[model samples]
Target: MREPAKSKAARTIEVINRLAKAYPEAQCELNFANPLELLIATILSARCTDRQVNVVTARLFKKYRSPDDYAQSDPSDLELDLKSLGLYRNKAKSIQSCCRRLIELHGGQVPRTAAELMQLGGVGRKTANVVLGNAFNINDGIAVDTHVARLAGRLGLSAHKLPEKIEADLKKLVPQEKWTLFSHWLIWHGRRRCYARHPDCLHCEVNDLCPSAFRFD
Candidate 1:
């Protein structure tokens, strides 16, 4: 039998409660001191792991302290600094272009709203949501990363494949106040237990609540 909307909403909250307890310290793992640093880190994080991004940013942040620094940096030097990461050249271009737009449009300040964030080069819906939720503490929308998307499908929260659609489905079930934390919770769960290739269903905290539990076994 298909679950009703109200019932599913209730179950979703229960799942959130359990995951929250399981991963109390889950958060934006990419280290940053301010909005601009977070914004730049988020951009560099595309197609890369947060751990790797943090490693590079440890030195990168110290060198490029502001939008003006990135905007004015030599492209080759920036690329050389980011050479260890995949797509170093493209990421370098994105950082420079994004910073230039930030300086030109917002006076070198990271925008507070998602719409304005998306307007910058290389900043998409996912990036904008990350900045909004983590940096600005605004729950404008959920950032549907691969982890969140996978967990949503496994938990029967959404059947959609597109990130925007999955985000819409999640927003309908999750409370507005919890929108940001919900993404963090699902991301933490996905990383810690509900892996894509081999989910630890036997030890998963939300196994009973999940629809796809044990199916991967």
Candidate 2:
């Protein structure tokens, strides 16, 4: 049976509290110093791990210090620099095109709004939310990454399969102030405890609160 909205909201708060305790230091694992660097790193992170993205960005950030740097660079050279990532060619093109858009439209600055950010190449609602919440501290919306999406369903928070729908469901339950931190908490839990294949429900802090707990065992 579907849970009542009132009870579900209460459970959601408890889940967030438990997750907060479990992952007190959880935050965006993607390494970046500023909004622009974050924007570039986020674009490079498509289908790529944060650790790998960070490894590449350590050098890439040094080379391309600004949108103009990426916009003006040779496409071949840029692709070569990002060749280690999953979709290097496509990501390179997207990054260059995105940077050009930034230069031309936003004055070479990462836009603070999700709508503006989404208009850029290789960017969608998820990427835009990530940038807005993490880079600009603007809680326009939650970022429903794979981890967040999986955890949401497993926790009985949302039945929706699409990220937008899941995010919409979460936004209703989670408080406005903790929007960004809520994503971090769920992501950390998904990574460390509620893994895709073999979630450690036995030791999971929120196992009692999770309706799907031990179902995979």
lDDT of 1 by residue, 37-128 (tens): 99989988888888999999999999999999999999999999998888899999999999999999999989999889998988999899
lDDT of 2 by residue, 2-120 (tens): 76555889999999999998899999999999999888888888887898999999999899999999999999999999999979999999999999999899998788898899999
If scored against the real structure, what TM-score would every candidate get?
0.96, 0.95
Clashing pairs in 1: none
- State each model's CA lDDT, in order: 0.92, 0.92
At residue 147, what lDDT does model 2 achieve? 92
RMSD to native, candidate 1: 2.1
